[model samples]
Target: MVNISEKDIQLLQEQVISLHKEAVEGNAKAVKDLHQLLERVRSDHSDIPLLDAYHGSTMILIARDKTNPLDKLRWSKSGLKLLDGAVSSAPQNIMVRLLRGKAAYKLPEKHFHRARTAIEDYTFLIKRQIHGEGFLNTKRYWQLIYELGEVYHRIGRNQDASICWLKLKNEAQDPSFLHLLQLKLKLLEGKPSVEYIPDAESPISNLIRRAANATESELNNRLKQQKK
Candidate 1:
């Protein structure tokens, strides 16, 4: 395996972060510009499969815009193919796996098989954590746990989801994350069975909605207090 320098990794991370911001804001031109930057990096470092994966994932993000549905589908499929090839070539590369897992998680229900691929990646990371080989005691670790919990809930494994959130709640010190876990747990508690119905919205979505509503209410209350 070709080794990437720390400086190179840092530069790539910064570029990816900027790309993510542009993608989230739906800036197609900025995303294209970022892709060009990545292409330059890829040309300079042709051995880095990670850059290929990033470029592919960025294309997927660009496809999320409300444009031609058929073109969007084509781009998404192309991205997934690139990701799959990268991962297949480097099965143990955590960075590539993370990219693929995140991309898979956002796919529609018609792509449940692809979603399962994300679940597999998350499961592998958790297993690595158990053996002290993966990230521990870090925000990234907790975020993975949270995402794994959401995946479990999405797939109707309520019990597993509850366990993941409970573990997170026990270990979490951050007030906001703890509150979110508590909300997740609360939503799970009233269910009669461990199996969540596929037709219903997942508890995670409810948690998000509840959190948003709480934030809005709090902001309104603060405004009222200011007026008083």
Candidate 2:
């Protein structure tokens, strides 16, 4: 590991802060600035663990918003190459693969396997939490999970999509919300939410409501007859 002086790190910190602001604001200029920061990181603090991660994530964003997906792929590969060269130096480097897989997935749907692998790596990294940086903030694991699921769905893989949604659905941890989400998915896929009511908003939801109301009244009538 290359040692960087505190003074140099402090200098880099200021630039990184400004670059972060630019990133949040969606400034077109931020991409160039982030590239410049990565260059500085490589030059000044070659083995610092955080630098490659930050660079990898920024490169993923660049790949995501590029006017041409093909051109973005080249930049994405370049970022990954940089990470690959130093991956041994930064042994627990989930961000690099995660970013690369996300880029590859964007470039082509056939690359879903790559995205899946990246997600797996990230999950392990999150569990480890090797650094103080909270893994959830550092990575978009859930978003990628959803995206991967959607990609599978696009390829007519309902079963695979269901796999992802079931995990996501279970994560909600509320039975009511879980049922709502399940019902929503049923609506999305043009399936029935329940035996009596079809899945739909507005008119269909209303129809379901009316059906329930009628059933409630029927139960009340039965109760009244029994009471008599």
RMSD of each: 8.2, 15.9
In order, the Cα lDDT scores of the candidates are: 0.69, 0.52
Where is the poorest 10-residue window by lDDT in model 2?
Answer: 193-202
Which residue ranges in model 1 land beyond 4 Å of their true spot?
A: 1-27, 39-47, 110-113, 133-137, 190-228
Write candidate 1's Cα lDDT for 1-228 as tens digits.
Answer: 456798978888787777866774568887888778877777767666777788778877766653555555667778888888888888888778888887776654333245477788878777787788855557778777877787677667788889899998999887867777888889888665457455434332332223222322453353233223
Residue pairs with backbone atoms closer than 3 Å in model 1 (clashes): none
Please write out the lDDT profile of model 2 over residues 122-208, one tens digit for every residue: 445545543555655422444445555544454454665667667668666546545644753574475322222112112322322
**Candidate 1 TM-score over all chains jointly:** 0.70
Q: Mark the regions of model 2 whose C-alpha exceeds 4 Å error after superposition.
A: 1-3, 6-25, 68-70, 86-88, 93-107, 110-113, 126-134, 137-148, 151-160, 173-228
Screening candidate 2 with a backbone cut-off below 3 angstroms (N, C-alpha, C), the clashing residue pairs are none
Candidate 2 root-mean-square deviation in Å: 15.9
